[model samples]
Target: MGFFPDLPITTERLTLRPFTRGDVDAVLDYRGREDVALYLFDAPLSREECALAVQQRILQTSWSEEGDKIVLAAVLSESDTLIGELSLIWRSEDARQGEIGWIFHPDHHGRGYATEAAGALFDLGFQGADLHRIFARCDARNGSSWRLMERLGMRREAHFREHALFKGGWDEEFVYAVLRREWRNGG
Candidate 1:
């Protein structure tokens, strides 16, 4: 249950860490790629732009209290290379629930990194942060990420049509949830 508060979070082959000023280059390198930002809320960002965004996020997470948000950078444990990012946001006024999401470099896709990091964040959000539930919503067209949600034992609770506008017109999406009572890990 021990986590690297601001340094890094380690998995067998990955390390979930916090953002650093030095991370500007990596953030710029990957974030600027169209494929990486395709599903994200924003368009491709330059390194300078992402650095500002990263700093803002860092400030928010660093100053958060018990019932606030948590964002982690997924890095390669061995080399500590930042590969992706994950987040847990407590949207409930009482901080009883959270919403989780992630974005990984396309080069790092299909390696199970997103799912592994997501599960770890879920554990932290619930067991560590004492949240009652953690859920995620994404465009239905994002089948890969949605599949990861299912793999993490979340159940699809809702599907909204034309709920958002992406690169073009409207988009439909699904919501998935997992309650604290329903979470289980392999022994």
Candidate 2:
């Protein structure tokens, strides 16, 4: 057996659980928007693509080995509306390192939902999985994402300058990381 948090992890305002087949439409609400996909690896998904993505996400609920991940749907606890998604990818089992990322509905911005959801993931990674370190990366131009990482108590570790070509242009990247000690110390 490997590290896998029990499903339906709850925070103050959101529930993080495995994606269900019925979640396609809700996922498409944000994933289908151009602005939402601006910093993501993939472009805005179509309805069909969202369905496929949800299907893929449904099977990615466990992190049992290196390269495995837990992809969770972030739903409103009050309304049960799917507003976003969170992921924790196991990058190196030997090093006990993980990578985290998030995407939320544009309409749901500014309410700290991303931070709440990501905090839960941090707990799972650090407390549940016993990971030594967790990191997040975002496009340098994505202020909101890096800011959210900061709010999660992550420190900026690196700033890569135009290292990779993305969306037909040079893409600068920012990497942020937190250690288990820092997270457990309430950071």
Candidate 3:
């Protein structure tokens, strides 16, 4: 069986599943917004870009080697409405390390969906993939992102100042991580 034999992982309120062509519109709703794209590496996506992105994500459901990434659509279980996206990258096979990231629609902010979804990802990494460590990085100015990381029991491992130029200026970054032992030990 594959790392995650379960295709659609269900949380209390959301489901993390592979992206589909039908998800273009829902995904575009947030990916096309300027505010949502602010901290992201790219600018707001156009319709065509969103469509192509979904096409790419559709094939990113598996992991077999270092650098391989799996992207999942976070959908509201009751409505099957796509509200955000999450990703896990196999950073190192020898170190058993991975990276996690998430981007949710602003409308869904303040809800516990992101935290729940992240926890689910942590499960997949630690249990499903037998990973030793999973980490996440975010712009230091993004309070919500870091706060969510903390809520997931990930500790701030690094604070990089002026890490690189982002959005036309120097940007600071924060890296948060949690070990498999900690995750399994109730934090």
How would you encode candidate 2's per-residue C-alpha lDDT over 12-79 as one tens digit per residue?
98999999999999998999999999999999999999999999999998877789989999999999
Q: After superposition, how far is residue 14 of candidate 1 from its true place, in Å?
A: 1.8
lDDT (Cα, tens digit) per residue for candidate 1, span 1-187: 1222444556678877777787888888788999777777889998779989789657545315444556778888877788888888766736477789888888888888898899888777666766688889988888888999999999999999987777898988899999987888421
Name the 10 consecutive residues with the lowest summed lDDT in model 2.
1-10
Worst 10 residues of 1 by lDDT: 1-10
User: Which regions in candidate 3 have their CA more than 4 angstroms from the true location?
Assistant: 1-4
| Candidate with the larger lDDT of 1 and 3 | 3
lDDT of each: 0.78, 0.93, 0.92
Error of 1 at 83 (Å): 0.4
Off by over 4 Å in 2: 184-187
- Which lDDT value does model 3 have at 82? 93
TM-score of each: 0.88, 0.97, 0.96
TM-score of 2: 0.97
As for candidate 1, its clashing pairs are: 9-16
